[model samples]
Target: MTGVNFQFTRGKRNKANRTRSPATERVLTQLKMISQRRKQPKLLQVCQEDHIRHETITTAFKLYRQEINANRAKLLLKQYESIKYAMEDLEQINSYLFHEANTNQKGKRFDLEMRIPTEYPPNQIWLHDYTPAEVAEKK
Candidate 1:
């Protein structure tokens, strides 16, 4: 017969269902019992299964490293912003103090040092850009 026209025929099969070996059946029965009793499988229980422990450990390590790097990035950004604000304040003070000076008859010049009070008395900081009371009430 040509390859295209060839047909396969079935032979007589074994009458018995190929039974699982006794040890395999016992293990399967134990697994079923454990699964029935426990709602959640413990990580240690799953790790005992072959080849899964390495994958789980590696994934956990990577997640922890990512969290550490993210926290470090946030801390560095906060430090940068703090330094930037301090520099801005220093620039403002320098401009106010040294931009103009007065010369006396002996040509001795004195640049006035404008003192920004170190103490923040109550309500010293400007409070602008707050949402209007009426708008806040509507929200």
Candidate 2:
């Protein structure tokens, strides 16, 4: 028996794809503000070993960002290689079609709607399959 990769999901996902954006900047800015305020009197003295903790946090954030960058790069590279291989196969089958595809796909931006599934796959994986107009017409 094959293992089931099934899970329930609601497909109304947002296009919140981050492109070269660092979460660390916002956090560091707040940290900087806190540090600046340290000069004045404070209500609570919770920040013990402030410099060391700051360094650790900064380092961890940088490392995490690098890891995310590397993973993204790897996924992109895999996608690129797959596309290249597909083009090669298409060229082998039909050169004209391959040329048309290669030439026409010049200024196409990557669609953010096609997201990598983190948990379970989206309920409506492909938008092209279901048409409300068709359903209306049928009824």
Candidate 3:
């Protein structure tokens, strides 16, 4: 008569080759067909056609939201950069016009004779760190 004695036994595990239910098999087949056809099926359409729960459909394509968001973010970043470049160009033009107006006030009619410069300054455009530590140290 000890405290408490319990016997534990491990049950046989299910085999990997276990068959899926017909409904599950059909849903999987429909998903594969949709993917192969390159058709972007709407959630409601998939739910109606596959006769599966919306939760199941969402879980199966869980990574899709991340991919879509990533693409949207990339496109937004590109648009932002283009707009920034355009703004910089406009600012440069405004400064040029201001300078021309000042010169005209001083009796020089250069704005009508001289074409405004549209090209950006060479030192302004950059894809990486424009001012390196070495250059800053030299300055």
| Best candidate, lDDT | 2
TM-score of 3: 0.28
Model 2 vs. true fold: TM: 0.42
Error of 1 at 94 (Å): 0.8
Per-model TM-score versus the true fold: 0.33, 0.42, 0.28
Off by over 4 Å in 3: 1-57, 96-139
Which 10 successive residues of model 1 have the least lDDT summed? Answer: 96-105
Better of 2 and 3 by lDDT: 2
lDDT of 3 by residue, 18-127 (tens): 35556877899899888885669676545454765666788768878888899999999999999778767766879775555446344323432244666765554544
Taking the tens digit of each residue's C-alpha lDDT, what string does model 2 give over 3-119? 755445556533453222368556876888887843676565556698679889999999999999999999999999999999999999999998888686554655556577688
By summed lDDT, the worst window of 10 consecutive residues in model 3 runs over 104-113
**Model 2 residue 19 distance off true place after TM-score fit, in angstroms:** 53
**lDDT for each of the candidates?**
0.65, 0.74, 0.66
Question: What ranking emerges by TM-score with the best candidate at the front?
Answer: 2, 1, 3
**Candidate 3 — which pairs collide?**
none
User: Per-prediction RMSD in angstroms?
Assistant: 24.8, 24.7, 21.6
- Give candidate 2's error at residue 23 in angstroms: 45
**How do these models rank on lDDT, best leading?**
2, 3, 1
Report the C-alpha lDDT of model 1 over 1-139, residue by residue, as the tens digit: 4544433546643335324567877899899898885469566544455557778889999999999999999999999999778767766778553333222345333322333556665453544655655566699
